[model samples]
Target: MRITIANHKGGAGKTTATVNLAAALAELDKRVLVVDMDPQANASRRLARPFDRDAPQLTASEVVRSGEEGVAAQAIAPSGWPSPYTELVSVLPARFDLDNRVSEAGTVGAVGRLRRALQGVDDEYDYTLIDAQPSLGHLTQMAFAASQRVLVVVEPEYDSVEGALRVRDFVKGYAQDLGQPDLRVLAYLVNRARRVGEHAFQLEGLADRLEGDVWTPHIPEWTAAKDAASSALPLQICGSARGPEMATLWTELAKQIIVEGAA
Candidate 1:
């Protein structure tokens, strides 16, 4: 399965969800591929080995720019994690130069470039998770066009909720136009949630608005998430006090994704 973790709202934890979920999926003995489509390259930094990015090498930018079949294979590299996890996960890193793809979005067949670049390449992994840039622009469109499903991450705030809704509507309205009629938002994941009044209100509102599409056991506002990112480690292996708890949440989410993908 190819899933894109997306939200137009910055600081909504999209990259956090993508890398940790890849870790959780690897724990289940699944081979995972992470594609970083953000110009910020946050996901690339977290998931890629230091040496991989130390020197110039092929990246997602080249993959999309070339739009050649099976070219993504050349960009794939081992994840930064040690041991078993590193063996199970791979990354297609991106850099700041990925932003250049935006200017080429108006060219003919631009939206399909990524899908074409990734052709026959995903067969090596059980799941491919794409960390899209925090926008609904051309870059994100390329990610969506290549994905089979989208996982929208949001914080419990007005702008985040509105951004999630906009992502839902964008996929619903444009999937067919983009040549992927089966594309859809698989679920809405609430991140950085708390037991406060505002968060409770937003959670309730989201349930009422998006109905069954909202996922259960909302992710809590845990410092471990930030610590893991800072250490460039997966929550499953970050060794923080709450790391296991956070990893459990992601494991559940990964299982849910597995079930949904199988269905």
Candidate 2:
């Protein structure tokens, strides 16, 4: 299954979810690769940087900008997580240069270029998660074109929810214009939701408004999540605050993706 985790607004926990879910899937013996399409390279720093700072990188920018040549083969790198997770999880790191080259590289055939690039490694992993930049731009469109499903992560805030809704609507036009009419947001996930009454109300309201498309077991607000980001650890692997919750949530999300892929 190829899934794109996106949010047009920053600080919505897209990268956090990607790394944790990728770790969960990897623990399940599902070979996984996280394709960090975001030029911010935060995911790259968290998952890819800790392993090897000295190795030459093979970022997503190079693959997508390679045109028809299919350079994704060279872009794959092990996440270097130790023990059981070591070989199972890998990353396609990104760098600052990706952001710089976006204007020139994201032109005609941008979607096709990404599709072809990913096709080179399609058979190597059972699950591929594309972490999109926070926008409705060509990079995100290319991610949608390459993915079987979209996972939109939103925090339980007025502005974050609003941004997510706008992205939900934008995907429709993006799919049509990019020739991916079948593309759709398979899951709408609420992230970092506090256990307060107001937050609960907002989540319930979002579910009602979206006709029950909201995913089960929304991620709870936890300091461990922030710690994981800083320590370069997947939330599931942290084995600290809310670790079990993160583990189970991602496991269930992975199950949903498996069901969809089977369908």
**Cα TM-score per model:** 0.97, 0.91
Candidate 2 regions with alpha-carbon error over 4 angstroms: 50-54, 239-241
Q: What RMSD does model 2 have?
A: 2.1
What's model 1's TM-score?
0.97
Residues 56-143, candidate 2: write the lDDT tens digits: 6667877777855557878778885666776888888887667655576446676666778877676778988989888877788778
The collision pairs in model 1 are: none
Clashing pairs in 2: none
- Cα lDDT of candidate 2 equals 0.78
RMSD of each: 1.3, 2.1
